[model samples]
Target: MSDVKRIATRESYGKALVELGKLHENLVVLDADLAGATKTAMFQKEFPERHIDCGIAEGNMIGVAAGLATTGKVPFASSFAMFAAGRAFEQVRNSVGYPKLNVKIGATHAGISVGEDGATHQCNEDIALMRTIPGMVVINPSDDVEAKAAVKAAYEHEGPVYLRFGRLAVPVINDNPEYKFELGKGIVLREGTDVTIIATGLEVSESLEAAKKLEADGISAKVINIHTIKPLDEKLVIESAKETGKVVTVEEHSVIGGLGSAVCDVLSENYPVKVLKIGVNDVFGESGPALELIKKYELDADSIYKKVKAFVS
Candidate 1:
């Protein structure tokens, strides 16, 4: 097996928070007793004065973040995705989303990759929950570099934002220094004519690998990295769908109300095309090794390759 460096998005988020803290003195961080797990400890260590540990109260954390935002402080509130989106839904919708506060929700350990945490901890519907809130900028980064850059973008953004990071360590796909991350824009990783693979989060790397396998089989595949789910790149999605004629959406979240559904909504309204959605199929996640769960849920690279091949054939 070829060795490629792997690091969790949560790790990147933690490091980026510290980096952002250096540049923006007004940046503050809050964690609902998951600083270590969410990797917010990195920022906590560097800027303890600005970090607040909310002691497992996810809802309270959101409330505090909103309060801070009004004081002109950019608060990055974090918790496991399950609590951040589920437990604090009302608070986020009412306090942050309603007022359009400048708070950032760093939801870590999202998707089936939370591994041994079982159904209760693995939050597959966070993206759906986040996007429903009006004016909430939803971002699910694909890798370490993208996740790092996304944190900075969220900090600079004016309104409420949700940044989803995975628990599992994934390969660095956007290692190119020239790669610029723009909110609401999709990046085309590979261009092809047969089909387009639009993916986000940890699934983006899998889609890229699947594209390589597809090429060996004489099938051309286009891979588009969609880091931002809300305010999606409708222009790029329409153009790619028009060119390739077939589209496949891969995401680590539930198939419903996530990237797949979002992309289909764009295509159906504009340029109609066939779309194969590869995701959790609206089911809860179970406990297992992260990689094992990935294969079982049909989100692995081999599974993605097989599914895409069958779709194209």
Candidate 2:
């Protein structure tokens, strides 16, 4: 147990990239014209020659990043998830993903948390798209510590990867910098037997809060953080479901083929637990505050508590 703090996932990327850049000169950063906003500017300041600002054209940026990867350079292309996954999808699929290049696509402002930016900026389907790509690894880190750990892990992992994160500050759950983080492994934050709430990204913090709130109401909730979405920790998920009997999956992304879907895909085959999903219900988010958007889409802790309560009762 550690003191809770508030921080954005994007800041973690900037901080982590700078540290990695210092250690490895091959760690190059590319931005689709949004260095300042996406925080790639930090890397730009540290490694000017290694930072490439490929203005606005996300497709061309992907092509260039893939080329850099071919030359034994690790390129982390920074942009909003919307443009990275939507606009340059074809380029990402053809060049980077198809070849399984050693490139890290760090897309910030993901999900509905890109507040007041509306649907065009907030991307809720990036995970589904990136996870579907063959040989592509999709990761959505829970907090600043996990985000930094993910950056380091992505650098070591050889192939095309997608790291989705948000601009808004959420609660910092992991305090120990020494906490072991492995790819495709789930972290059990809290243990219980009544039900299991599997969550990822910002939803992980919400799930922890929901678990605490549920405990006050006499419900024992199991909270697990699924940081890796593509190669999901099916063993942990299935084992948790077997213990809980019922489960609830939550994420800032859509319920369709995201966290919830991935959990269901695992449980249905082995454990077979009743799952209630909490996420953006397959619709675009409108312009509003990030908290308001999360509330509207039922992606908060209260919503998760309510949904799990219903499933249990």
Q: Report the number of backbone clashes for model 2.
A: 0
Instruction: Give the Cα-based TM-score of candidate 2 against the true structure.
Output: 0.97
Per-residue lDDT for 159-196 in model 1, tens only?
99999999999999898977999999999999999999
Q: Distance from true position, residue 305, model 1, in Å?
A: 0.8
Question: Can you write out model 2's per-residue Cα lDDT over 39-77, one digit (the tens) per residue?
Answer: 999999988999999999999999999999999999999
lDDT of each: 0.95, 0.91
Show where candidate 1 strays beyond 4 Å. none
> What TM-score goes with each of the models?
0.99, 0.97
TM accuracy, model 1: 0.99
For model 2, the local distance difference test gives 0.91
Worst 10 residues of 1 by lDDT: 1-10
Instruction: Give the candidate number with the greatest lDDT.
Output: 1
